[model samples]
Target chain A: MDIVVENLVKRYGNVEAVKGISFSVKHGETFGFLGPNGAGKTTTIYILTTILKPTSGRAIVAGYDVVREPHNVRRHIGVVFQDPSLDDNLTGYENLYIHGKLYGLNNTLLKERIAEVLKFVELYEFKDKCVKSYSGGMRRRLEIARAMLHVPRILFLDEPTLGLDPQTRIHIWDYIKRLKDEHGVTIFLTTHYMEEAEILCNRVAIIDRGKIIALGSPDELKSIIGNDIIYVRVDNNIDVCSKLSIDGIQSCKTIDGETIAIQVRKASEAIPEILRYLEKAEIKVKEVSYRRPSLNDVFIHLTGREIRDSGGGFIDIVRMRHRVR
Target chain B: MMESMYIMIYRQLKRFIRAKSRVVGMILNNILWLVFFGLGWAYTLRGPIASALFRGLDYLAFLLPGIFTTSIFQASFMGGISVIWDKQFGFLKEVLVAPTPRSLTILGRAIGDALVSVVNGLIMLSLGFMLTSHLNPLALPIILVIGLMVALGFTSMGIAIASTMRSPEGFQLIVGLLTLPTTLLSGAMFPLSNAPYWMQLAALVLPLTYAVDLIRFHLVGISFLSSVYWWLTPEIELLLLVIISVILIFIAIEMFKRTTIE
Candidate 1:
């Protein structure tokens, strides 16, 4: 394992931010801490990265215990925080040069690596430009480039795509995927975006309210609910719900008394049969849609609530950030 | 460690040079004080106006040392607000997670402020020489040495105070409150002799008092603040300032250590 957490717990006063969570990441794998805003995701990353101390449990990164060997962990790992950490006054090149120096990179290797990383991120042409002039996407790319200058074994990204446009978010994810394929660096990132987790993470741990409610590969997690979900919006919904209760249907739910959500192992095989039954009953279906189960559905099934904009997690992260320092 | 310190100091100097407003503001502050107060005091303290008060020294010459100390003290100490800036910008977290020892970051700020304040002090000194026309060519070396010492000492004091301050406005407000009272009590504007014993004790505790007294004694060969105690000699004040500066920098490192990911 490249990273391991053995019952990690972190508390601020009487509130527990992380409640004895345990998980592990294999080497070179993209392991995601999938949670909305303040589900203890940032706190866990902080503890694992040695930014904050855990109250009772411990985490080990790259064969070193975080509490006992923080320096070693820092030397070998890199981090890109949720917020922008770049110094706008400095040129992109200067910022990277200074970060290189801080990591004790030798003068020659620092120069070589700075050039290489900047070019890889396609930022070499604009390296001389002040960071203030760069767009949000460019700045995020530069921060990621800076994080990789030392070529760390593991990279920790705390909501790396937070507040960014969808286009920019895709650009960052492209680089993240490339890093794992080309360099084999272990990636441990946290995000509230379920699609991001589904696409990038090889395995994800669904965290909520400081606990790991579910953990598995994307396929494994979706398989737990069923293979597929079929939504049938019919005028005679009671007829469809009663008919879906027969064979080949894992479960059927009537939503708002308008649509019947039917889960089955084979959506393609069941849809035609369900259509036949509806036609025989003269049900007159209004609309129909079917797709595989998503991480969002899994979260809703587990928590019995949807992750929305007013997710109480955001305010806690912002309010506590200012008061702590 | 040494590499990080050198680069950090270089970064600070680069930042200082780029901040054109800061340079102009420091020069203007010095010019305003010298013309309005130094020249204004010149007319009142001339010939036989308590010769014992200034020890027969010219008032403008007397006023120059105090101005030098005040400017350097303000600039160097307030420069510590850069830490709060780094904190706000999220750069401090990046630096903290680096492999280098934590102390280097604090030391870098202290030394950078010290060097910048030294230059700032000399600029005020040159302007002081031009305005007063009382240049002591023979005393120039000792004056610069003492000036550098005062700059380093006070810059450390600034970093110590700044490390605990989370905002630049709050840092400036606290530094402003401190600068006024210390300047008044340091005998920068008048002699501390006839002041109450309690006021004298308060003056003794301020680091600026020692800096002003040391610079004045070096430039004009007179310092009544040193006569506060029989054993409070020039050497003792210098020793105390040095000790206080080291202690302050040490305190700054400790405060920097306590700073978190927030």
Candidate 2:
């Protein structure tokens, strides 16, 4: 492993921000720290990048202790913060040039490297323009380019595409893939987007409330609950809890009056059995389909909350108020 | 370590030179002070105090060096506002996470402000020459050196305060409160010799006092320190200033290390 964190603990005043979390990333692998808001994902990144010291335990990046050898750790890692860090007053090229110089690049090589990184992010044409003139997406690309200017062994990106549009987010993903494939750089990224984690990460650690709840590949994590999910929609409101009390159904819950998601050991074997029971119960099923379980399901199964809530709570409230009326 | 320091200094100097608006703002500020205050006083008070203040030199000659050094003081004192902004904008994180030493980071920023102070001082000196023919080539270099020292020390103080400030607005409040007292106490606008005893005492406590005294000594041959007490002049003040600057730089480094978001 190129990065190892053991029982890491960070506290802010009376609050324990990162409560005894531990994970490791191998050399030249893309690792994702999956978590929701205030889940200590950024706190972990800050500790690994040597921007924040661990209050207890230890972190080693590229064989240098983050606390003892911060300078060495800094030398080996490149970081793109969650916030924009570029100098708004300077041109994009000048910003990169300064970053390169700070990292000890000679003037001649700094110029060359600036051009190379700008091309990598596809911002070479606008390199001479001040950053203030660039859009948010453009500035983000520039920040990513600046972080990679030094060719670090490990690149840490904290929510790299948080506020970017869908198209730009996908473009940044492609750039990240190229960086890892061509340069063989280890990437550690944090994101709340399940698809981002599923697409980019070879392995992931799901963190919530400053604790790692699950750790595995995308397929492996989905396998925690089951292989496939049976999605059913009924025409009328019914008690899903009562309907779900049938055999061969591993677990089931009402998504709404029209939709219910069920997990089973084998959807091929269980669906037929489930349909027979529903028919015997005189339940009118409008739609049914068998599909692989997504990270959202895994998250919902583990955290008891939807990864992305789809207005279910609001709809429920409105239904209650309407019934009263 | 030295090579890293050199790289940091070079990067800082480059940023200082590239920001044209900052340079223009500093020049405009110096010009306004000269026109409104320096020239205004000369025109209104043609009394002996004003003439004696200038000595045999032109009025601008005496006022120019004071204004130049004061400009340097103002620029350096306010320079750390950028550091506060950097913290707010997240650029400070980039710099803090670099392989460079923390003290070098503080020194590099101070050097950046020092460079600006030098440039602004030279522009004011040049403008003074154009407005008046009182040219003392020998005294010019001395005034420049003193201005640089004062600027460097004050920039260190700014960084020290900024390192402790949580926000840019907090930094502005502190800078504003400190700048007025320091400026008035240093006698940047008037002679301190005839000022009230308590005011003189307050002026003596400020670094700008030594700065203004050094400029006055070079320009008008009026030494705040008598010949018998020549050793107690700016040498002591310079040493004290350097010591205070070193301590403040150390504090800033410690704050940087502690406050960096991990």
Candidate 3:
């Protein structure tokens, strides 16, 4: 194993941010922590990266205990935090130069690696421009390039595509994928974006409220929810779901206030029975849609809530931390 | 460890040079103070009693060394604001997670600010030399050494305070509150010998008071404390500043080690 975490826990005053969660990643594997905002994903990453100490527990990274050998773990891992860590006042090349120096790269090797990583992230042409002038995607790409400058064995990315457009997100995903394939680097990432986790990670632990509620591969997790999903939009979803009882339907969950998603073995057979039952019960359905089970469906099935709705509070906390009371 | 220090200092100097407005503004502020306050005091203190009060040297010559201490103190202390900036902007996270120890990071930042502060002090001294002829040109090297020590001492103190603070505005306010008392009590603006026992006692503990007296001794061959205590000599004062700066650097590192990404 490249990473072994056993009963890791962290607390802030009375609040338990990470509640004794334990998991591991094999060598050169892509692993992810999937959770909503403030669900302790970043806390776990912080502890593993040795940036934040765990209140109690043990995490070993690159065969070194995090608490006892933080510097060793740091030397072996690269991290791209959820927030932008680049110095906006410095040029892209300058930022990379300093980071390389921090890692004790000699001047010649540092210069060579800076060029190579900048080229890898496609930011070589703009290396001379200050980061303040770079667009959001450009800044993120530069951060990734900086993190990759030392070429560590493992990389930790916290919400790598957050607040970025879909096109930019796809571009970043391509870089991450190439890093894994070309360097055999083990990747441990935390994100609330279901597509991000599904596309990049081989195995994921679904965390909520400081606990891993479910853990598996995308297909295995999706299999936990039935084959098909029927999404119902109603004026009173809770009332409507309570009245409908159909055989093919495995479970009914009110995803949001007005939408109730029903997991079923076969949508074609279950849809008609569900509609008929809703009609006979005198509950008016505004709209109905059906699709194959997605990771979002799995989350909704397991938690009765959408991750997107609860996925945004972390950014607010970042802003709040910057403000003076 | 040395590599980490070099990078941290490199980043600080890079930012210092890039901010053209800050560079221009700081120099301009010092020049205005030198012209208005330096000349105004020179004119006001030209009488027989006032001349005796200035230890028989020109008032501008006496005040120049003090101005050097003030500018260096202000600039070096203000340099700590970068810690709050790094914390706010998230670059501190990158530094903390690097393989190097935390103390090296704080020490590098302090040394970087010290260098910048020394440069700023030299500029003010050069400007003062142009306005006054009483200073000995040969004393420049000794003056430079004392100036660098004062800069390092105050810069480390600034970093120590900033590492514990989160808000830049709050740090600025606290530094402002500190700068007033330190400048006023340090004999920078006036002779502490004529003051009351309590105020003189207050001035004795300030690192800037020792810095001002030492720099004045080199620049004008006068020492206010030579009559007060035989052992409080220039050599001993320099040693005291060194101890204070080293202690402050250690404290800054301890504070930085406790800082988290919360």
Name the top lDDT candidate.
3
TM-score of chain A of each: 0.82, 0.85, 0.93
After superposition, candidate 1 runs with Cα above 4 Å error: A230-291, A309-325, B50-52, B137-145
Which candidate has the top score in DockQ? 3
Q: Which candidate do you rate higher for DockQ, 2 or 3?
A: 3
**Across residues B1-262, which tens digit of lDDT does each residue of candidate 3 receive?**
6989988888888898998898898889889989999999888888789888887887899889888988889899998898889989999999999999888887888888888888888888889989999887799988887787778778877887888888999999999999999998888788888999999888988889999988888888888776676788988998998898778777778877887777
Number of the top TM-score candidate: 3
Each candidate: what lDDT? 0.82, 0.78, 0.86
- Candidate 1 C-alpha lDDT tens digits along A1-325: 9998999989999999999999999999999988766789999988888888999987999999999999999999999988888888889999999899989899999999999999988999999998989998899899899999999999999988887888898989999999999999999999888888998999999999899999999988887796687877777436567655458787777653566668888889898888888888888887677877788667756775444432323222333444698
| Candidate 3 C-alpha lDDT tens digits along A1-325 | 9999988889999999999998989999999999889999999999999988899989999999999999899999999999999898999999999899899899999989999999999999999999999999999999899888998988999999998888999999999999989989999999988888899999999998899989999889988875888877775635666767767667777655677777888888888888888888777887777888767777777787668632323322323443655
iRMSD, all candidates: 1.1, 2.2, 0.7
Q: DockQ score for model 3, please?
A: 0.87
Ranking by lDDT: 3, 1, 2
Evaluate residue A242 in candidate 2 and report its C-alpha lDDT on the 0 to 100 scale. Answer: 71
- Kindly list the per-residue Cα lDDT of model 2 for residues A19-137, writing each as its tens digit: 99888999999999887888899999888988787899999999999999998998888999898888887789988877886787887888888999999999999998988899988
Clashing residue pairs in candidate 1 (N, C-alpha, C atoms within 3 angstroms): B77-B158
* Model 3 regions lying over 4 Å from their true place: A309-325
TM-score comparison, 2 vs 3, better candidate: 3
Which CAPRI category fits model 2?
Answer: acceptable
Candidate 2: regions farther than 4 A off? A227-243, A253-261, A264-291, A308-325, B1-7, B10-18, B49-59, B224-240
